[model samples]
Target: MLRYQVVESFLSINGEGKRAGQLAVFLRFAGCNLKCSYCDTMWANQPDVAYTWMTKEEIYEIVRQSGAKNVTITGGEPLLQKGMKELLAFLAEDESLTIEIETNGSVDLTPYLSISDRVVMTMDYKLPGSGMEDRMNLSNLKKLRTVDTVKFVSGSREDLIRAVQIMEEYTLRGRCACYLSPVFGRIEPVEMVEFMKERQLTGVNLQIQMHKVIWDPEMKGV
Candidate 1:
């Protein structure tokens, strides 16, 4: 039996992504490959972080009972988990649930792409501020489908500029949904908007973490 190191599981509205503000069952797996400077879930990635080892069936039960149609498999980097493909395959058996994977761009997405069309992805392109930019797998950019989303979390003006360059270089605007999000307190939303307007970054959406606005930013399982 393949067991997952699950840090936490809860029912909360997706704070970001294409399904932002919609109710979802979040399954946050433990551990990560890259350490971003502004990582809000550092607690979940610590070496001593407490976690429950769960099988695919157990995880499915949690999602099934949540009564949420949308399911988010987030992390400290969800794709790093062993047997993730099996877990996703098991989850996809439930036709009613809309599944989404929130992956840090370092992981190769090609393996997961064939799992199921139901398994849409919301991948991050770690910006310069994250300190994990070089670890990103650039090949993943071409693998994104129309239903997928590529998110750039910017913490500074330089990061924002690099994000635009990557967007244009990959022609991400029309290939998939492109989003620009401010790293919680690092940069102002208006600043990002101004940059977007100046660049005429059409088709790119600017988003803030809605859950942070609704509840305390540091609050867990929200």
Candidate 2:
């Protein structure tokens, strides 16, 4: 089995995106293909941190002991891992468990779509301020199933405008929910909500980092 840079394994509330506040065991994989400027998880992208490499069996044992009915496959970029698929398959043995994955909205997830029926994909679409617009997989947006969702984190009026325009331009599937999240402290959630209302942007919803607002924003592992 290939080695995995296991960042942290702890039982915590799912802080953002879907399944928020649900009991979850997060697998924060280390390493990302794109470097977004607003990325709060920039720590995971670094290469120097100490990591533990474990096989699928070892990971399952840890997850079982955690007593978490939900699992969120997060990262720097969990999909970047070579055996991520195999690991997901192994976890699928637990029928009642809900699996979720957070991606940068740049990788090809078609491969995992078939096996991960219960997996809710929280895909982050890069806005202009993110400095990674070119890295986006536009095709991946169209390929997303109803279970998959697209998210755009806006830092300014320009960023929000672009996000709405792109969704309309691509004729993004109506089945997918369009998530518009602010840059936390950088952008006001109320202002963002008002903008969406004034523009009458259909298929749009607001998202805030609940854990950040309720707990220590600087903390990690829930």
Best by TM-score: 1
Q: Residues 1-222, candidate 1: write the lDDT tens digits.
A: 899999999998999998998999999999999899999999999989999999999999999899999999998999999999999999999999889999999999998898788899999999999999999999999899898999999999999999999998998999999999999999999999999999999999999999999999999999
Whole-model alpha-carbon lDDT for candidate 2: 0.84
Q: After superposition, how far is residue 113 of candidate 2 from its true place, in Å?
A: 1.0
> How close to the true structure is residue 137 of candidate 2, measured as C-alpha lDDT?
83
Q: What alpha-carbon RMSD in Å does predicted model 1 have with respect to the real structure?
A: 0.7
Native-to-model Cα distance after best TM-score fit, residue 3 in candidate 1, in Å = 0.6
lDDT of 2 by residue, 1-222 (tens): 666778887788887766777889888888999999888888878888657888888888888998988888888889999988888887887887878889998888887888867876888889999999999888787777777778899998999999988888876638676789889778888889889899987678788888888878888877
TM-score of each: 0.98, 0.94
